[model samples]
Target: MMMNKMREIYGVVNMILFPEDEDPEMLSLELFSSFAKAKERSEEIIKEFIDDYGEDYIEHVTKKNPVAVMGNGDVTGYVYIVKTHAL
Candidate 1:
């Protein structure tokens, strides 16, 4: 379910995981800083746009990762998701 705006995305629906999961901790995004930093980064990006193209051209865009990790310690497969942009 990819989306388009400024870029192409592999997600829009099921922003977490599909079919859910047995353990809530497995797919939870508590440890990820990207989601937490999104708002702050968007503010900075918006400011940049506002400065260049004016406020009207600026849009409040948000980004997120939907991957998840399951298991414990080394056995836990940690799928790293990275956001190329962050303020």
Candidate 2:
């Protein structure tokens, strides 16, 4: 038998770094279970990025989303999610 599961909260980090005239290099990192966890990880990522690429290059945003995921142990499902304003 299948049952509905509680919606999961996820945090996403998006970043773009490059000169205006050049192509933007963007990275999307996801898979965190909570906003705090996501933010914490993003901070670490930001530090590393800044150290390697410099603070001047980064355009950063953290997106918090609540996702309704449907599935069974067999792995068939759909994900419905909404994105909240960036922080």
Give the poorly placed runs of model 1, Cα more than 4 Å off. 1-32, 59-87
lDDT of each: 0.46, 0.43
Each candidate structure's TM-score, on Cα atoms with residue i matched to residue i, is: 0.29, 0.29
Candidate 1 C-alpha lDDT tens digits along 1-87: 232322222231333455453443333433344666887897888687678666543332222343556665444543434333455
Candidate 2 error regions (>4 Å): 1-33, 59-87
Local distance difference test, candidate 2? 0.43
Clash totals for all models, in order?
Answer: 0, 0
Residue range with the least summed lDDT across 10 consecutive positions in model 1: 3-12
lDDT of 2 by residue, 1-87 (tens): 122121111111222232243322221222323566978997998699679766655532222333445466454544334333555
Q: For model 2, what is the alpha-carbon lDDT of residue 69?
A: 59
